[model samples]
Structure formats: structure tokens, C-alpha cells
Target: MRKPRWWAELALIAVVYAAYSGGRILVKGGEASAVEHGLAILRFEEGLGIDAEHPLNRLFTSVPALGIPADFAYASLHYLVTPAILVWLFRRRPAHYRAARAWLMTATLLGLVGFTLFPTCPPRLLDAAHGFSDTMAHFSAYGWWGGEASAPRGLGGMTNQYAAMPSLHVGWALWCGVMLWRYGRTPLAKALGVAYPLVTALVVMGTANHYLLDAVAGVAVMGAGPLLAPYVLRLVDRLRETAEASPVVSAGCETSAGERIPGQRSVRTTADDKQEWGLPCSSEAESLGKAR
Candidate 1:
């Protein structure tokens, strides 16, 4: 197979991000539904807690600025860490690009879906109904993306303003962590692999940008991406098969067992061919004009 290149994938990423941004900007801001949804979630979580005075929830609700000092650490996540890791790994580890992109895109799609379906406000706005006050009010640096001009206006904020459940911030960290752990060799990378999600969990919690459940959902998305990607591809493969089976189709060659087909040609049986494309040989196939 011809190896995939990074530039094409980067271009694709741009397109995906633009689409995501555009779709998100369409939701109504300051919707009452958002507040109600957030309250319901809070109540559900309260019910599920260890007890009425669930220590974690109590502490979490009581301490608004829990992770405030770590705001800069959290901010650096999107602005620096994730993109850098993805870019560097993209060039150096071409083999992982497709899987990584598929996972990332799946997570993105789910996140957008969450925004549409369950538009809950973050703790910043969850005070009245939840009987909570600003735990993150003092943290000026934390709300960098909260303001209007700071966010990219994609054809006018079609986005859900209060979509805080399933924190993509936490989801991305988990994604990066897992990918790095699976594919990387370096110790520092591996260390970051374990630490990224943990740190992100803290960041979101401390700043009250997300509830514990949002982080849970984020982690769930990252974990599900890889597992789900194959099924997604199978669906694509099925569509291609269906399209090809139509009457007007001139079918491509189907190689017999143990045969390696060239990109340009096909055969039913194995044979020694002339050229090897310098790729690691995988099966019995051939091309023209080179050493044995």
C-alpha cells in the first residue's frame, strides 16, 4: 500500500474543524433549557453519589475554585500540547495517522452531538439551581474561550453556548494519552501518556469547566473511538461494495489466495515480479523491472 502523507491529513483536519465550528455556532445562547438540563444532570449525579452528603460531590460543589491555580496548565492543553503532540507524531509515525484521525473525528462528532442533545452549563453558571456559587469566578485566565471575540465566529455562533457535559478537553487528553502510550517509545512521551488525562481531569475539576461526569463522558469517547473505528470502516467498505455491484460496473481484479496485487494491476495467482517498491514485503505479488 502507498503510505499516507501528513499534509493531506492536516488539510482534512482543517476542513473538519471548520465544519465543527460552523455547526456549533448555530445554537441559541443563554437558553433556559441549558440551565434546566444542567440542574437535572446535577440532581441525577447527586442521586448517584455515595450519599446525600457524598464527600466528593460536597467538596466539589463547595470548593468552586478547586483547580484554579492549575488554570494555566489547563489552558496550555489545547493551545500547545495536543496539537504539538499530534503534529510531531503525524510526521514521524505515518502508520498511526489514519487510526488517530478516525478516533479524533469520532470523538468530535460525539461531542457535537452532546452539545445538541444535552446543552448543560458549566459550574460557572450552575450556581442558582445546584445551590452552588462560583468556585471558578476568581480565575480570570480560565475563561479565555468564554468570551465572544475570542471564539471563532463560524457564520454566527450556531454553537451551543452551554454545552459543558462531556468535556472535549478531557476527552482529547485521554485520546492523546492512549495514542502515545500505544505507539510511542520515549519515556517522557509515555509519562505524558499516563499523566495527560489525569492532569486534564484535575484541570477541568479545579476550574469547574466540567463536572466529574463530563470528564467521564470525555474519557468514554476517547476510549470508544478506536474500538468503534473498525465498525465505521466496515460500513464504508460495505457501501463501496454495494456501489461496485451495480450493473454498469467493470470490476477490478481479485487476487487469488497468497497473492499480492500491485496498485496498477491485478492477478489471480502468485508470481515473482521484477520491482520491489522498498516497502516491507507483505505477500506474494509482483511489479516490473528491478532486482529479485
Candidate 2:
């Protein structure tokens, strides 16, 4: 494994994040369908006798002090913690960062596809008749959020409220936890790795930002991402190999002696180069040929 190109990697991450953000905003239609699906999901949970969001939200709101912190976690940590972990991994564990990043990106893309295909409204968006409380709305004053799920004041409309079926929040949190558990050296690190995702699951449910099934789907997505990573990485490797094999200069750029012309580009001479004009010897040309 070669050293990863930092600039290219950062640029790719930034571009992908922009695409995901823009994608959520662009796929903002079918509210009626989304509402119907959300209701159906709620009913399905009721049928299973595992519908916990209502009780959870009620418990959270019962303690105004706790609700404030939970709201802050739901609104902030979902975005902050994942990237912080990624940067840490990039700096400290470059060997593991590639696979971790690939898995996260894979799950995120799958979540986007879910949003496009099944835009189910979150519990917050459900009607009051359904016994759902907008916990964030109820506790918005204590935090920066303004009654909308994680969106700032007056900018709530920019976000797609219906993109809530498969919660990337839970998925990313779990991914972070998994990475930490597997790679972290200390016991406290491992404990926090397990704790963070569990806390995120509770936060998303308590804040009414996602369904129980949504969090389950998030885990399922993460599971699928690792399975798909091998194929995706192989494709990326093939593309990189193809690009490297292509010529970097014109066919006639170098003469039979394989020496650079004057004023084209400065060629640095190494210690062993004893040629009259500092030209590369036959052995050097052979090594360059093999490298190419």
C-alpha cells in the first residue's frame, strides 16, 4: 500500500458530502406517499408490539433538562462525531482508514437511495393525532434547533424532512463505534465505541427523528456496505491502474538517448549519473521502463 494522496482524498470526501446534501434536498417530493408510508411503518411496529418511540419521546420530554441535552446530541453529534473520528483514523491509522471510509461512503450512498425510493416522514412530522410529539420542537428553545429536525432557524425549509426512512445518523454512529472497538488500543476507547452507537440509537428515537425500524435499517445498511466494499475497491483499483498505464507525455517527447531537451523541464542529476550531459544511463532507462 502506498501513501494515500491527502488532497485527492479530502477533495473526494468534500465532493461526496456535497452530493449527498444536494441529493437530499433535490429528492424532496411525494409528501403524501411519505406520510402514508410513515403511518404504515408505525402500524407495523404497533403490530409487533415493539413501538418504542412514543414512550421514549414521552420519557425524554418528561425531563426538560435531559431533553435539552438529548436534542443537542441529536442535532449536533450526528454530524460532528463521525467526521472527527474519520480525521483521527486518517491521521493515526491510515492503514484502516481506507476500508473504514469505503464502508461509510457505501452505507451513505445506500441511505441516499433509500431516501429517494422511500421517503418516509419521521415521527416528528407525523400528526399530533398519531400521539407523536415533536421532541425537538418541544425542546428547541434550549438548543440551536428551531422546531425542525436538526435544521437551524429559518433554514428548516432547505432540508428534506421526508428523508428519514433509513437514518444515516444511526448508521454512521455505529460505524464509528465499530471502528473504535476494533482498532482502539485502550479499554475506555472500546467502551465508548460500543456506547456511542447505543446512545445515538436512543437519541434518534427519543428526539422523534427516526423510527425504530429506521435504526434497524441503518445497521442493515452498514452490514451491506462491508459486503460490497471488496467489489467497489476492486473497481477503483482497476480505474487507477488504467490511468497509471496511460502515457504521461507524447511519443516523440524523448529521443533515442532518452534524454530531456534543454528548457523543457529541469532534470535533477543523482550521485551515480556519470554521463557527459547528465543523461540517464541504459540501466536507468531499463529501470524506468520496468516502472512504467
Candidate 3:
């Protein structure tokens, strides 16, 4: 297979970002439904005995210094780390690039679908009675983001605050982890692959940007992507092979009585009477010539 071009990859990344941002804005108006879904998720977490988001947020926010870093992780690392790892994979491990890229895109698009369909609000956006503090707000002056989530202060109104289900921050962090762990040559690299995602999962929950269940869904989506990609790729390969093998029907090269004749192939014998069927193999053509 041909290697991917740098310009094409850059363009594809830009397009994907544009689509994600635009889709989030378009599907973000369902506030009441989002709140209900977020509440339902919290209740479901309690039922499953994994209600950690609230306490995590409370603990982290109790320490402003710790909360600042967690907020930074949510706002910046979620956006930066995935793309950086993707570029590294593309350049360093071309053989693994296609499958990894497919998995990432599939998981991310699935997250978009969840954002549109479920539209769960984040813990920070929940009622003040919930005791959830918006850590990003508390540390907004330290970073580029506004009092809300990671959007710029001026552009905060344009972002999708309610699109919180299936937390992509955690999902992307996990992707980075998988790539580093699987491909890294050193012990430190492997350790980072495991640590980064774990840190991101905690950071998202601690910053009130995602629920425990949302991070769970994110991991589930990432897991499903690789499982489904192989089948989809196999189907595509079959279709491509079928297309290449199918005969190409066209008008005959020679004319008869000023009209084209059908059933005649485009290939012809050479001037030396050597049979050629538009293929370049001399031994095969010699066999055809002898058969003729």
C-alpha cells in the first residue's frame, strides 16, 4: 500500500475537527433532555456502585493547585495528545497506521452520534444544588478557556456544553495509551501509555467534565471500533477485488463495414506473431502464442 501523504493527512484532520465542532453545535440545544440524561447516568452509576464523579470532583476542587492541573488536562491535553500520537504513529509505524486511524475515527464518530442522540450534560452543568463546582470556571483565569468548559472565553457561547455522554476526552486518551503501549520501544514509553489514559479518566471526572459512566462508554466505544473495523475492512477489500476482476466492456478497436463489431477483445498479436493479451509477461504470452 502507498504511504499516506502529509498534506492529505493534515487536510483530513482539519476536516474531521470541523465536522466534530459543527455537529456538536448543531445538536447542542437539548438542555432539559441533557440534564435528565445526566441525572439518569448518575443514578445508574449509583446503582452499579461506582458513583465516583461527585466525590472526585469535590476532592480535587478542595485543592486549588491540584484542580488547576486537572482542569488543564481536560481543556488542553484532551485536544493535543490524540493528534500528536496519531502523527507519531503515521510516521513511525506505517503498517499499524491505517487500523489505528480507522479505530480512532470510528470511536469518535460513534461519540458524535451519542452526543446527538443522548445529549447528557456534564456534572459541572448540573444544578448548583448538586454541589458540583465547575473547576474550569475556578481556574479560567489561569487558562485560555472561559468560565464554562474548554471553549475560548469569546467563543464559549458557540460550543456544545451539553454534549457530554461518551466522553471523547477519555476515549482519545485511551487511544493514545494503546498506541504508545503497543508501539513504544522503551519502558518509559509503555508506562506513559498506561498512565496517560488513567490520568485523563481521573481528570475528566475530577473536573466535572464527564461522569464515570461517560468515561466507561468512551472506553466501550474505543473497544468496539477495532472489533468492527476488521470486518468492515475485509468487506471493502472484497468489493475492491471484485471491481478489479470484473471485465471492462468497451467498443472494439477495429471496424467492420464502418460499424463497430462486438465480442472482440482489445488485445492483438504483435508484429512478430507473438500473442499478447495486453499483459506484460513474456513467458505467459509465449504460452498463448504456442496455444494459438
Candidate 4:
């Protein structure tokens, strides 16, 4: 397969990211509804005896070293590591990059759909009685993020705080991990591939930015990506082929007999050119002339 152009790929990524960001901001559900959804999720987890957010949040907030780094990871690595892996794939694994990119984009769109459908308040945003702490808020002085959900200081208002149903942070990290593990031949790369997603899931929970179920939903979204990516890629390819195959009509073009034909170029043609242009051969032309 021919490698995609770098500039075109960059533009595509930028457009998709912009759409994703805008979708998040636009789909901020009402705070009351979001809180209710979050509580419902918490209750469901409790019923299953798998609610781990409280313990993780408590552990992280109580320890400075853990909280500080986990805060940093929650705020920064979601933006940095995913793209780094994308670039790595584009540069080193061209053959796999297209499918991987499609999968990532598909999963990201699905995450956005989840955000739109069920905007859940994160554990950090829950009441004090919930026993969860916002690690980013606690470590605000140490990093650029304000008390808000990983947004930079004073810029938190720009982000959708309630769009936290399926955590794309964990989903994207999973994507990056899979890419590294699948494509990176180095042992270190393989190790990072396994560790990155697991650590990110922990960090997000420890920071209270995502519930365990949110992380599970994120994984579910990524799982669906591979199954859907082939159809998405195939649709794109079909559209591209259709565009390329469409005839381009040159205005004022005419045949030798003064008959204007749509989509015919205005140029003299040789036998090979006639064949390429879908025009009649010399013998056919002569026969047509005699009949006329």
C-alpha cells in the first residue's frame, strides 16, 4: 500500500481532534443529570462489589509522591503519549498506520457519543461524603492544571467537566499501548505497551478523574474499534475511488465532426490517445463518417 502523505495525515488528525474537542465542549450535560448518572454508576459498581475509586483516590491523595506524578500523568500523558505513538506508527509502520488511525478515530468518535449520551460527573466532582479526592486539585500548585479536570490553570472553564462517562484518556492510552506492543519490535517497546494502559487506568482512577466503570467503558469502546475500523476504512476508500473515477468535463471541447462531447478534453488525439479518451478508433470513425 502507498504511504499516506504526511501533510494530509496531519491535517486530517487536526480536524478530527478539533471536532472531538468541540463535541466534548458542546455535549456538556446538566450538572444535576451528570451527578445522578455518576451516582448511579457508583451504586451499580457497589452492587457488583467492585467499586475501587474510593480506595485508590484516598491512597493517591494521602501520598505526595504518588499523587503528584499521578496528577501529572492524568493531565499530560493523555495528550502527549497518544500522538507520539501515532507519529511512531506513521514513520515506522506505514502499512499498519492507516488501519490503526482508523481504529483510534472510530473509538474516539464512539467515546464522544458516550459523552453526549451519558455525561457523568467524575468521582472528584462528587460530594465530600463520597470519599474521593481530586489529586489534580490537591497538586494544583505543582502543575499547570487548576482544580478543574486536567485543564490548564484558569482555562478549566473551556473544557467540559461533566463529559466523563467513558474516559477517552484510558481509551487512548490503550490504543497507544496496542500500537507499541504490536508494531514495536524492541523489548522495551513491548514492555511499555503492556504497562502504559494499565498504569493509565490506575492513574485516572487514583486521580478520581474516572470511575472504574468509566475505564471499563473506555476499554469496551476500544474493543469495538477494531471490528468497525475495516468498514470505516472501506467506506473511505470507496468514496475516494468514486471521486477519482468521475469524469472531468472540459468546457468547449468538440469532436472532429464538430460534435461537442461532455467530459472530452479539447486536444488533438493519436490512436492511443483516442483509446484512452474513450473515443472511436480510426476505422470506427471512418465507418461513422460514411454512414453520416
Candidate 5:
């Protein structure tokens, strides 16, 4: 595979992120429906006895130390660490970068679809009697986020508060974790690979920004990414190949003789083609002609 250029990769990421953000803003599900879906998820989790949001939220809020940092993490790390890891892969593990990047972009687009289809409210937005608190709201004064999700203080209105199902926060953390663990050579990197996702899951739950099911859905989304990424990569390759294979003249005249050569076409031979055909390259052909 050809090595990807940093600028091109950056532009691709920026465009994808802009699309994801714009999709989230546009799919603002109705408040009543969002809450109902949130309740449904809560009931489902409770039936399975995995309703961890309440307890986690209470623990985070009751202690400022835990609550403040968790809020910061919920608001910032989702934006920060993912890109940092992408840069790390580009610089340190170039061979693995393309596949990893494709996987992440595919998963992110999948997340946008989930957000569009299932815009469930977060645990924090449910009824107060549900026993879940919005730790981000509680600790808003300590950080840049406001009463609304993790958007900036006054800019909170710009974000879609109800797009909580299949939390991309957890999904991205899982992606980052996998990249680090798979490509990172050091023990610390592997250890971080395990710890990062677990911590992010806890942070999202503890902050009441996502339900346990949302985190599970996020994991499921990440799982689906790898399976779909190869196809995406292949499609991109085909498009690139098509663009590169522009039409060439089918026949051309020899300037010296001024005669047309039928069935002769102008084609650029790649190194692989020369190897496969066992043919001398242009330079070698020239050297042989001179020797003759």
C-alpha cells in the first residue's frame, strides 16, 4: 500500500468529523420520544441487572474530585486522544495507519447512522426519580461545559443533547485502545490500550452522559467497523485506480517516418507490470538499444 500523506489524511478526517457533527445537529429527535427510548433502554438494562448508571453517577457527583475529572474527560478526551493516536499511528506505525484510519472513519459513520435512527436521551436527562445525576452539569463550574451535554458554556445549544445511544465516546476510545495495543511495542502502550476504554466507559456512565446500553452499543459499533473497513478500502482503491487509468491515444505517428502505427497505444508501465511481464523497463530498453 502507498503511504498516506499527512495533509490528505488531515483533510479527510476534518471532512468526516464535520459531517458527523452536522448529522448530529440535524437529527435532533423529539424530546418526548428521546426520553421514552432512554426509559426503554433503562428498563432493558434493569431487567438484565446491569443498570450501572445510577450508582456510578451518584459516586461521581458525591465526590468533587471524581466528578470534576470525569466531567473534563467526558468533554475533552473524546476530541483529544483519538486524533493524538491517529497521529501516533501515522508517524510511528505507518504500515498500520491506513487500515486503522479506515476502520475509525467507518465506525464513525456507523455511529452517525445510529445517532440518526436512535436518538435516545442520556441517563442524566431522564426523570430525577431515576436516581441519575448529570455529573457534567453538577461540575460545570469546574470546567468549560455547561448544563447541556459537554458542549462549551454558551455553545451548549449548538449540540444535540439527545443523541446518546451508541456513544461515539466509548466507540472511539475502543478504537484508540485497539490501535495502541495492536501497534504499540511497549508494555505501557498495551496497558494503556486496556485502561483507556474502560476508563472512558466509566467516565461516560459516571457522568450520566450515556447509559450502559449505549456503551455496549458503542462497543458493538466498533466491532462492526473492522468487518466493514476492508470493503471501504477496496472501494476507495478502485476509485483511485479508475482516476489514475485515464484514456491514452490508441494510435500515434512515428515522427521520423510520418507513418501511423495501428494497434499501438501510449501506456505507462508501472514497476509491477514490468516485473509481471518480465519486460525490460524504459531505461533498460534504452541502454540495450544503445549497446546494439
Candidate 6:
């Protein structure tokens, strides 16, 4: 089996990420529909208290400090936690890398759609509400949090700050949990498989980085991809089977490669590459029945 060239692999990642980032810039810059969604969600908060009276929010916000002011702990964790978790996911189950990448890309698209449609403000931004101070003002925050890039009302920034309806932190953590449960089943792995997301849910609520409905949106986005990715993959797969194959690119990764021949040029042969898609693994059959 020929191997997938590193350059080709890098090229694929670059193209995908570039599209992902560009999509974010274009969508949030408009804040088209996100305003309506944001306002509606904000209304839900009217009956409940997000301040000192809400013990659930307080416990989530306070646990990280162990006594110190937890806002920074909450914020710091919010900022730093995702990349590390994603890194672990990729390293532990590289087999799911493609699916993981697709999930993230889809969520970004969904976020932009939300931003454009429902441009709403977060609790921290609600001036009429009592006991709300822009926590970001006191703590160091991301250079670009949302719509602060253009006029206060304009949508010309890295993101639609109002796009908080889908708690991506929840979405990604749930994605991580499902992937571990499906592909990396071990005792500790299974426990964390559950815990990481529960903690992430806590992180979002405690920090007020997201509202409850945002978490719901995140789950919704993740669920949508399974239905959507299959149809997309069918198109890619039709191109994969012409009996000419590469060493590095797996026939299973997408559907455009040819049959396996013993030359290693287009594939990577990583441990994970071998486990799931090592299609082109052998030239034994033209096309075979997939396992159940």
C-alpha cells in the first residue's frame, strides 16, 4: 500500500480550516438573523435570576476558585480548555479526526447562521438587568469576543457575540463524549467520556458564557451533521472507486481513491489510519460488503 504524502494531508487541513475561518468572518459580520434569536433568549431569563439568588449558577461559578473569585477561573478555563480537550480527542482517537473536523466546521457555519439571524446580547451586556457588570471589563478577555469589532450595533467582527444561543463548548464536549463512547471505550476513558461534558456544561453556566438554550443549540448542531455528512460523503465516495489507489490517502477517508496497489505514496499509515479506513489495505476485492 502506498502512503499518503504529508504535503497532501497538510494541504487538506489548510483548505478546510481556511474555509472555516473565512465563513466565520463573513457571517457574523452581518448579524442578520441572530438579533431576533438573541432577544427571544434574553426574554427567557426574565423569570429567573442569574445573579446571587441563583445558587446553581453560583456553585458552578464558585467551585473553580475553591474560595478565590471564580469569575477569572471560569473565564480562564473557558478560554484555555477547548483546544486542550480537542487535542486529546485527536490524539486519542485519530480515527475520528475527519468526523471531528467536519463537526467543528458545521458548528462554525451554524454559529454564523445564528449570528446573522438572531443578533442578541448576553446577560453581561444587558444594561436594564440588575447586578450585571461586564465581567470582561474586569478580567482579561479575548481581543475579539464578538461584535465589538465594528460600531456597537454593527456586525463587523470575528464573531457574532450574540451567537451565544448554541453553546459550542457544550456542543464540542458532547461530541467528544459521544466519540469516546463510540470509539475509545475503557473504564477511565468511559468515566471521563461522561465527566468532561458535564464539567463543560458547568463551565458554561458558571461563567455565564452561555445560556441553557445555547447548550441545546450546540447539541442540535452536532446531531444535524450525522444526517448531513452522509449525503455529502456519498458524493465524495462515488469518485473513490476506480481501482487506482494511493498509499497515504485512505479509500475510506473519502470516496475518490482507487483500489489498493502495493505502492506507498499518498497515505500516512498512522496507527489510526490503519484501524478504521485502511481501505486500499489490500487489493483482494473490487468492492466488499462493509462490516456490521
TM-score of each: 0.68, 0.86, 0.82, 0.90, 0.86, 0.60
lDDT of 1 by residue, 56-107 (tens): 3345445545534455555565557767777866788777776787788888
Q: Which stretch of 10 consecutive residues in model 6 shows the poorest summed lDDT?
A: 144-153
Runs off by more than 4 Å, candidate 2: 248-292
In order, what is each prediction's RMSD in angstroms?
9.4, 5.7, 5.5, 3.3, 5.7, 11.4
Candidate 5: Cα lDDT at 28 = 92
Steric clashes per prediction:
13, 0, 0, 0, 0, 40
lDDT of 3 by residue, 1-292 (tens): 6688988888978898899889999988578889999999988888988979889999888998789988877888877888899889989998999789878887888889999999999999999897799999988889999887998888888899988889888888999999999999999999999999999999999999999989999999888889888876677679977776554323233332323345666465453432222323345444554576
- Ranked by lDDT, the better of candidates 3 and 5 is 5
TM-score of 6: 0.60
Lowest lDDT 10-mer window, candidate 5?
Answer: 249-258
lDDT of 4 at 83: 88
Residue 179 of model 6, lDDT score? 67
For each candidate, the alpha-carbon lDDT, in order, equals: 0.63, 0.85, 0.83, 0.87, 0.87, 0.53
- Which pairs clash in model 2? none
The candidate that wins on TM-score is 4
lDDT of 4 by residue, 86-148 (tens): 898899989889999999999999999999999999999999898888888888999998899
Regions more than 4 Å wrong, model 4: 250-292
The stretch of ten residues in a row with the least summed lDDT in candidate 1 is: 269-278
How would you encode candidate 5's per-residue C-alpha lDDT over 1-292 as one tens digit per residue? 7889999999999999999999999999999999999999999999999999888989999999899998988889999999999999999989888999999999989998998898899999888999988888887888887899888889987899999989889999999999889888999999999999999999999999999999999999999999999999999999987776654322231222323346566454455755554443346443443464
- Of the candidates numbered 3 and 5, which has the greater TM-score value? 5
Order of quality (lDDT): 4, 5, 2, 3, 1, 6
